[model samples]
Target: MDKSPDAYWKATLRLIGTVLVIWFAVSYLAGIVFAPALNSIHLGGYPLGFWFAQQGSIYVFVALIFWYAKKMDDIDREFDVHED
Candidate 1:
């Protein structure tokens, strides 16, 4: 069965919202709000908080890019809206 355009777009928007929330949490909450607590732990000689504030968020963002693509593909297939 195929979904209507409204349903497909609703799913797409939900996915985008989910991704954005995760992005914001990792970038802001972990990096800024919880930095002091995270700083207690160290990774590769750098404080974990510092790492998250600088590099971790970047890495997570890149991972999110691929994750979002894969998720979008799954959503497309589920809705029978896929290109192929």
Candidate 2:
């Protein structure tokens, strides 16, 4: 059975929202609010915030986008939805 355009969009938005929330929370918690505690463990040439701000968070963001895309694709397949 074919799915409606609205269903595909809804699934995409839901994936975006879920991934964004997790990304924001992890980045904020590790980079700022818990920086001091996290600093106790060293990473490369920088402290926790420096590492997160400069490198770690960026890597995570990329992975998050890829993960979201894969997850959303699975969701679409489950619902018989497609962008085209």
True lDDT of residue 49, candidate 1: 88
- Candidate 1 regions with alpha-carbon error over 4 angstroms: none
Residue 51 of model 2, lDDT score: 80
Q: Give the range where candidate 2 is weakest over 10 consecutive residues by summed lDDT.
A: 1-10
In model 2, where do residues sit more than 4 Å from their true spots?
Answer: 1-14
lDDT per model, in order?
0.93, 0.79
* Per-model TM-score versus the true fold: 0.91, 0.72
Tens digit of per-residue lDDT, candidate 2, span 1-84? 436787777777888889978888668987778777877777885787668866798899998978987898798777866475
Question: Per-residue lDDT tens digits of candidate 1, residues 1-84?
Answer: 548998899999999999999999999998999999999999999999899999999999999999999999999899877896
State candidate 1's TM-score: 0.91
The per-residue C-alpha lDDT of model 1 at residue 16 equals 98
Candidate No. with top TM-score: 1
